[model samples]
Target: MKENIALFLAILYLIYRYKTYKNVNKIIEDRIENVHRSFFKRIQDVLQCSKEDAEKVGLALDKYFVPLKSKFYKIDNNTYSFVDEGGFKGSFSIDQNYNLLTLEYNGVDLLALH
Candidate 1:
């Protein structure tokens, strides 16, 4: 009976862990999707261009920007940096609402990011 109880508890713990893992993955997915959407919207608004054009620009920018969410994280919240293979470095910040507040590439201000 003691062995059965231990096995049951282990099973319960595994289920709990699986659920927690799924929740964490979902949260990450949602955050990434939100960032991409916000970036896309900003690109369209700034360029005053069609959806296709905005998408192309956004996709290209993603090469530099997505790393902010994936890697090169700073201890400071909402700030991230990216360095390309060519040694071009960039930084950007996100607001509480997931909006891009600022973007700088190689010391050049890419956008006002209001």
Candidate 2:
């Protein structure tokens, strides 16, 4: 009788762990679907392209963003850098925490906000 009670408790614990894992997996999957869906949806709306054309659009963006991201840097002095792009002048800052980096543009910085 004692062995039977112990085995029942073990099975219950295993079931609880399995359910928790399944819920986490489901949340991750939902987030992925949102990202992919919105990405293709925006492309289709902007370029008037069909869903079938997304591969080419994604390919072009992949090519463009590689070099575009290189120009940004973090200065140790912790002051914003200002730029004058003729029609636009700007100042910008980067605040980092863990794996996330957020860029904030001061009015003087002609940073591209996208």
Candidate 3:
């Protein structure tokens, strides 16, 4: 029916808009990461801790603690959940090939695409 077709079209349009927005958001995030990397990846840095340590800490905070602290986010093409309300705590992580930044909520791996 025409009504169904119109609804489908609307859904497709919404999807298009969402994808575009996500792409822009990702670009912004990448730029921010690049800025950090540029500073830390330098060979002759004067910082107390090495760039590797900083990267590790960043990974730990993001992969392990982020889900517990943040509301929700997607990383590496997968979505994750993190919610805490007193005793009712929730968390999740997604990882494949490596667990470098994978987060877990309770006992469930919410980040797995499979």
Candidate 4:
């Protein structure tokens, strides 16, 4: 009857919504992983350090450079400058390939450090 059809349609809608939500979450996770990898690579290259060292620095920096809590300004299409209330300041840029092109802290250029 019409009541049965309505119930079936509602179930289908719920299933569709669940799948969409799952897919969105997966995309966000992948993007976060990518960012982490890119940051580690940049740190390693700039600091001329090993993976372990880069990871250590990255973890420490994360405490101050959190994007959500920092005040940020868009510098260009793929670049942004940020300052945390605690006095940490930096800028970063990512290329189309998700490679980090630039990273700086407190007016010191990471790429030119060593």
Candidate 5:
């Protein structure tokens, strides 16, 4: 029947839309995970704290400064920079081995790269 065919097509369209939505969500999640994982690991190593503790500090900073989720820059092979959605901004550079080399937060150089 014509109605049966139309129903099947509509269902297929819905399924396609759902899958697209899921894929977009996954991409956004992966980007956030990458930003947090590498940057937070550097913070943890430099501060010499447990992963949990470093995460706490990172979360606090995010809460306070409100980083712009979509604004990211690759400073080098191992370093990245980001800007806050609000007033604060910061940047960090890592070494060849992925160690924290420098950190700059809110116009203050927190660490020296060399």
Candidate 6:
């Protein structure tokens, strides 16, 4: 009887561990999705380009610069700035509705270029 109880407890513990693992994975996936929607989707909308182009520009900025942390800063209620590790800089502005008004890279309009 004792051996049977032990086996049942072990099975319950495994089930609990599996559920916890799945929950953690789900949380991680949600966070990643949020980042993508907030960052990359915003870029795509502002640039008026495909998702691939926006991602290419984002990845290029990260990889082309020196191996350091890139950063974004809110310049105003509607504008944000980006600075790469290698001293490259860009900025974008959005309206109250969060629609992108303008995007510039190195003082040039990225939308026009795109």
lDDT digits (tens) for residues 1-114 of candidate 6: 999999999999999999999999999889657654455665555456577765654454333331224456667666777776778888767655445467776777766664
Candidate whose lDDT is highest: 4
Regions more than 4 Å wrong, model 3: 36-114
lDDT of 2 by residue, 1-114 (tens): 999999999999999999999999999889646655565455445444467564344333333232111222234433232222332322233233111122333342123344
Q: What are the candidates' C-alpha RMSDs?
A: 13.1, 13.1, 12.5, 12.6, 11.5, 10.7
lDDT of 5 at 6: 100
Clashes of each: 0, 5, 2, 0, 0, 0
The lDDT of each candidate is 0.64, 0.44, 0.49, 0.68, 0.64, 0.64
Which segments of candidate 6 are over 4 A away from where they belong? 1-69
Residue-by-residue lDDT tens digits, candidate 3, 10-98: 99999999999999999988975765464333311322345676455335434444422233333324333345444334433333422
Error of 3 at 68 (Å): 32
Worst 10 residues of 4 by lDDT: 63-72
Candidate 5 on 52-93: residue-level lDDT in tens?
765665554454443524244566555656675664667766
Ranked by TM-score, top first: 5, 6, 1, 4, 2, 3
Which scores greater on lDDT, model 1 or model 4?
4
105: Cα error in model 4, Å:
1.1
Model 6: per-residue Cα lDDT at residue 45: 56
| Segments of candidate 4 deviating more than 4 angstroms | 1-68
Tell me the tens digit of each residue's lDDT in model 1 across 74-103: 525766665656667777766554455667
What TM-score against the true fold does each predicted structure earn?
0.38, 0.34, 0.31, 0.37, 0.41, 0.41
Top candidate when judged by TM-score against the true structure? 5
After superposition, candidate 1 runs with Cα above 4 Å error = 1-71
What lDDT score goes with residue 112 in model 5? 43
